[model samples]
Target: MDFSGKKVLITGASRGIGKATAMAFAEKGAQVGLNYRNNIDEAKRTLKEMPGKGHQLFQKDIGKTENCKELIQEFIETYGRLDILVNNAGIFQHHKIDEIDFEEWTQTWETTFRTNLYAAAHLSYWASQKMMKSGGGRIVNVSSRGAFRGEPNAPAYGASKAALNAMSQSLAKKLAPHNIFVGVVAPGFTETEMGANALTPEERERLLAETSFKRMAKPEEVAHAILFLASEGAEYCSGAIIDVNGASYLRS
Candidate 1:
């Protein structure tokens, strides 16, 4: 869809899926807000590679609660509107239940939940207010399949995503009255920086075997799905979880 003049605020957009999503939106003629924490250089690199125009950055540690409101306000002030909010910024780690530390556990919980879930919630609330004043809008929460099936070692991360999925559903229900559509893109393992660094050869092969495609997803593949959900064309797709998993978990 042609998204000229549409504004999207994407979190963790310096690399991987977020970067790909931002570029895709830009190429489609949307103004993008590229959010990053510590990698301004990398974010700028991604921006330089983008095909379109009118993208800006707002760097803040979103894991901190205070930065959330600040970033959202900055987004509104910069773009003059918030048509789409992609809650894509997050951190991932593995843990064994017995070896998990209090700081580790709390950081995992706070960071993942705050960045993955709370960011969308705060932005959606404010963005929806803007969209309501102007007519309507969309929200695409970058969730994970881990949310639905859950994870063994990384319980906190899994639970946080699950909470985000639930929040999308609840917000969709509540926001539909004002024409705000909230949906989720729950992807399986993909060939992102985290996936490459975390997965061993044997583990990658094993994970690939889970998919009918026998491979990991490309960043653009998931971005295309997010674009669809975020479009005015998908106005009726509220409260839906679109699993872009290459048939990894297709039901019989």
Candidate 2:
């Protein structure tokens, strides 16, 4: 879809799926605001890689409530208005039940939940308000197949995404009358930097076997799906979770 004149904002956009998604929107003529936490070098590279002009970068940590509020305000001030908000920033740390101590467990849960769920929720709250005034917009949340399939090693991550899906559905129903559409993309085993670093050769084979394609999804593959969900024709798909997991996990 042609996103000419549209403004987009993406979090954790220095690399992987977030980077891919930002580039896709840029290619389609949308001005993108790329947000990153600490990777200034990578974030600059991503901004340079985008095809279009007016693409700016915001280096802010979304885990804090105040940062989330300021981020939306800054993007609006820079771009005038927002058309899409992709909540792609997240953290995935393993907290094994049998090995971690109580303190470690609590830390993992707090960090994961804050970065993965609360940040998205806070951004959505402020972004939706701006979108309402602009007449209409789209919010696409990047979720995970682990939400339904189970993340045995990362229970907090799984739970956070499940909550994200629920929140997306809730907002979808709440925002429809106001012309704002909310949708979700739940991808499995994407070939992102985090995914690559998490798997060994043996683990990779096991993961491949779980899907019919015998391979993991590329970042762009998932990005394309996100773009589709953000399109005007997809307004009816609000609350729908489109799977990009190569049939690795199925939900009825």
Candidate 3:
């Protein structure tokens, strides 16, 4: 599990699960590229907290195609090669069916898809090409339990995560021949900055009750699963989606 010379890039890495994942890699000796959109201060805080040196910060609005390409290119140029790509950047907006107007609903869908799914697709495309040239690499996608269980108020978010799972599987199969491994970690509600901002006291209580553990996952918990999927021995598990949902939702 040692990544002494590994170069990893994590998008949406300024805080929450992304930050935790970046730290996990850095602690294992990987040189990490932390990507954030608007939270420069928070991203800088994360950079300062990293365990190892040579970890760099990258600011990019991955929602745009050009930005996504640039983020990957910059990371490659800085580190020379990419060993892992973690697509953890995402946006969630509640565009309930009956409550929102058509325009609002459309906007939600467009923005959510661009940030959640399209960004991952574009980044993965460019990262995979670079990986192929350097022998091989790993791509670990951060999905959600909502992809399977559902997100009633945020239908677009649910749909995008589902699409991300499918995309990971597609790439896993396509990239296997080139020695690239792809896997997914689908986590339930984790106790992260985003979750803290989104959930109310009552909502948090209800979510806790719904889970078997009577609690939400910690960011570190999800990060451990992500690191495992990105490990060398996990090559045979390419295309696998490991659920880190604390038994909140089980799929047969």
lDDT of 1 by residue, 1-252 (tens): 888999999998999899999999999999999999988899889888887778998898887777877887898898887888888887677866789878877777777677767776776776777888877788899889888777787787788889888989999999899888999999888779977886779978888999878889999999999999998778788998989888887533
* lDDT per residue as tens, model 3, 74-193: 998999999999999988777889999999999999999999999999999999999999999999999999999899989999999999999999999999999999999999999987
Better of 1 and 2 by lDDT: 2
Q: Per-candidate RMSD vs. true structure? A: 1.6, 0.8, 0.8
User: Looking at model 3, which ten-residue stretch has the lowest summed lDDT?
Assistant: 191-200
Off by over 4 Å in 2: none
lDDT of each: 0.85, 0.95, 0.93
Pairs that collide in candidate 2 are none
Give the clashing residue pairs of candidate 1, or none.
none
lDDT tens digits, residues 88-168, model 2?
A: 998888888999999999999999999999999999999999999999899999999989988888999999999999999
RMSD of 3: 0.8
